[model samples]
Target: MAGSVQPRQLALALPHAESLSRDDFLEGPANAAALSLVDSWPDWPNRIMLLAGPEGSGKSHLAAVWAGEAGARSTTAHALTAAAVPGALATGALVVEDLNPSGFDERALFHLMNLAREDQAFVLITARVPPAAFQVELRDLRSRLRAVPVVTLLPPDDRLFRALIVKFCADRQLSVDETVVSYLVTRIERSFAAARQAVELLDGEALRLGRPVTRALAAELLRDA
Candidate 1:
């Protein structure tokens, strides 16, 4: 008993870099339209566009891909202000991400849209919900948001869901096979967030237990979850 080494007390929280490049993007029916719009670029139906999707639905990934190609500067809706609008669009392309009705400045956003129109700059706005759903106090801003072409990303289907599980595991450098993947696909929620979560949990548990990732390990880890 005295010579027995205790199991590792904690799993190291190692960071993993996720590629947001065009090549790393996983295309599927859920995101085809959004990907197409990002690829369309300067030829967009409108200079200002809204990308609407649920959390972890690849909205940021697609935005990053577009930003790389368009030389766009990125800012969050909460960080946007009337004073920042001019400099924000200095690159002729800007990404205003995570727009929430309660948090962002309505006047500043209105000014941004107006200035972007006048300067012919391309504005890509990302939000969890469609902008029309925002309880905007500014009538003009409301109208402007409605006029902007909306591209929505839907939940991943079976094929994409499986692909996402594999990619997420790969991102964490976790070696998972079809057995583990198949087990997870049926057990976890059908969304990007779920796949990412499942992999992170498996990775952490595997590290803590000093066990290889496999169907048996996954079952034991996820049995209570």
Candidate 2:
């Protein structure tokens, strides 16, 4: 018994955290600029504002916060069509997400931009890259997107990364320690996506093996990655 590992006694029900709300957002140096820009919306110098960031860099979460504040309707670039733009714009505040240059509808987006401007609607566009990098076939659309002010979300730093991991763990009701958090922060790549994946892998492994979340378990689960 002395040499054997002890199994953690977890609850029958998974821990439930509050829904993804603005209050849950952790604003540190990594995301403060982006957050500040988002907070300063409606008073933006330009009518169209672009939010760009790498995958899982909190762009969507921040967009959600903006949506709640402005009572905006949100959709992805692929889903935005010439036909759907009118209905989408009816919300007055609109968020068009993942507006990459490749495989996007330039005409539809151009139209949405024009409509948003005409209607005085506040538009928030999100993408993985800045609008300057997006390859727009339509010169008019290119010019339009280029004119939109851009805000970039930098990847999460250690503070934000650890906070995100803790939030992810709490969402799954996984009781992880500071040691595990600190361990994963150093071992894993510094990205929101990576943190989420690590937490997910550890949580699933712990549940499957009926073991507590430990440094050893984390090392085992993320060793290959």
Candidate 3:
């Protein structure tokens, strides 16, 4: 009993809080137009607008920022129903997020759009692809969606990509220097999703091995990634 060896305990997978406040939103050429549209607010070109972009392009963050300013309600596309439209627009501002053709309720969305126009409530729809690409059975809904003004968020530029890696590391309370970030910029895919993934993997591995995050560590992990 006295010579018994103890098993090593793995670090717990704790959740980290991401800052989605307007100030925390990174600004760059990639998302300038999208940010401008969000900042313009009530002056939107139309009562209902669509924000489209590839995955991890900050559409949700921008929507949150706009929702905060507009005092809007947020709902997912799949969760929306015809009966829910009225309450969804009660705040006079609503964010219908992640609207894809796969599982969305067409009739419900159609009702919401018409109702929003009737009541002059502002609506922000965020999707990975443009509404025009949706394959809906409702012809009227398809036409209506195609007419909604769209603003697209592009992939981030080099500066913003580097900044994103650093910010993601900071969010996980992992202190990483420019060398690590610079090395990641070249090694990882040039996208927000990739930056977040790299940081998460690095954090998990560092905690597992009890090592500090460094360029060498990132090199090893990325080489295996």
Candidate 4:
């Protein structure tokens, strides 16, 4: 019998696509406003946009989309310093994420913003809080940050959280029961990361115990978390 298409060969042949594409995102009231900004960013009237959200709120996910859409380069604030910014800013469309944590390269960031505007390129930024939260010494940089329209992703609601689980299970080809689903929706933290953790827990436990997803099994798995 002919060997079917090799998995490795098939994988390489398919074009690589954006990781957190619009299709992979979940639509719900919790994140509607932020989603709107991300989906419409390529056409945004401004050259700069800010995305703010707590951990697990999908800020990075949307930022990745912007990088792909704009064909821009991305880096953490830590890797960028004012001295290093000219080259980084050379890419008109760029993404700087984890601004507060990634070394907060304010000088580079400050210059990059101006460069983007002058070059007619887009710069997308994501952080845990609004620009007001950052301590700024550069008057112009502070004001530029303040001027950019800010988009925030609110925490996910329970319904959206559940839908996330279902999406993951479908993606993983795992068969989950309604009771198991309901149990997790209540017990897991109301966040996308929680959904991911739950799936991993369940998958591991199911494999260990050789059991199908059930309320009791979910309870057992969650209890261990």
Candidate 5:
């Protein structure tokens, strides 16, 4: 955040992209319900919320925003444990993205639920699919997951698609012309996830060329994609 330049211009430009903030995320029909749930936090009937959507549908983006706003903590389902909960969560909130994406750690999650409930802290979980559709091996965890409030996001629309590409370019200080942007939107994969991946590829190509993006390179990426 301080004295940082573009990643390609400087070998060490903050090293990693900044956390996805509220401004970086674009809202569309696919994301309105998820946005509303977070917007109505603490009054949304349940302090515990579950978010799931297609891969790269901005679930982690929303999770990070919520974590920042609430000063909440998080642990991937892989590393979560009971001892980890009710520590700093009571004063803030807790988010577990990709919950059971790898596999459900039922014992750890169940313990976390009890602790969060006791502490009156918020607990949010996210995955690529709804819990109902999650391929769970543990019956107890499956049953508990079904009871949680699940929010799903639709595939991103054009506005969201454009916004994500622009933000990616802006973040890297890469100057991409309107023609190139339009070309990417039209020829590249249209989903938010696809746009992000395409941007990364295009950004890397721009860095290698040490010049602004041109329609020619974009066309090549689209052609080769």
Candidate 6:
């Protein structure tokens, strides 16, 4: 007994898995239009498209899907510069995400748009607010973006929320049955972001306690919320 060895408890590594495949994305009234617009690219009414949605509304995932199909380079607004425009345009397609006008570089964006037009390339712009709401000092840039077709993703419905919960759980390697799903769907905040957060908390708590995900566990986690 004195020489007996205790089992080694290796540190758990949470898997980083995010699949942006088109098939994996859930469809509903809130995001149907935005998805449709992404699928209709190159043939788009304009070279530039504005995708607006709340946080965790799947705009970035949708953008990733579109980038794959269009062979576009994906970047954020803050990373763009006048010198980066020509090289980015060489890709023939681009996706600039999380564009906040306040800290955005006006001259760089202005040149980017001009170069995009000259190259006949396509650009997808994503943000929490619509482009029209931005206070762009450059009149031409504002006009150009204002005319770009805008697609907004609204909040998820019951069906979509449930699907997201299941997806999030599965992504984190957590097995959740219908009971857990039913309980959380009714009590959790009505958003994809909330679904993701709940699953993360539950998964962490379950791992810490060596317990399975269940309705009771979910209740304990959501109780404080």
Candidate 6, residues 1-225: lDDT per residue as tens digits? Answer: 999997745436577587899999889998999999988876788898888998889999899999999999987899888999898878899999999868678888889888888889999999998888899988998887788888999999888888889999888888989999999888878987888888888888888778899999999888877
Residue range 44-79, candidate 1, lDDT tens digits: 999999999988899999999999999999999999
lDDT of each: 0.92, 0.84, 0.92, 0.76, 0.77, 0.88
Error of 6 at 155 (Å): 0.6
For candidate 2, the C-alpha RMSD (Å) to the true structure equals 4.6
lDDT of 4 by residue, 104-130 (tens): 766778778877777888888888888
Clashing residue pairs, backbone N/CA/C < 3 A, model 3: none
Candidate 1 residue pairs in backbone clash: none
Better candidate number, 2 or 4, judged by TM-score: 2
- In candidate 1 the C-alpha lDDT for residue 182 amounts to 98
Clashes of 6: 0
For each candidate in turn, the TM-score is 0.96, 0.89, 0.96, 0.80, 0.85, 0.91
For each of the candidates, give the backbone clash count: 0, 0, 0, 2, 0, 0
| Model 3 lDDT tens row, 19-75 | 899999999999999999999988999989989998878999999999999999999
Please, what's the RMSD in Å of model 6?
A: 3.0
Structure candidate 6, residue pairs in collision: none
Ranked by lDDT, top first: 3, 1, 6, 2, 5, 4
Query: In model 4, what is the error at residue 7, expressed in angstroms?
Result: 32
lDDT of 2 at 210: 83
Each prediction's RMSD to truth: 1.4, 4.6, 1.6, 7.6, 6.5, 3.0
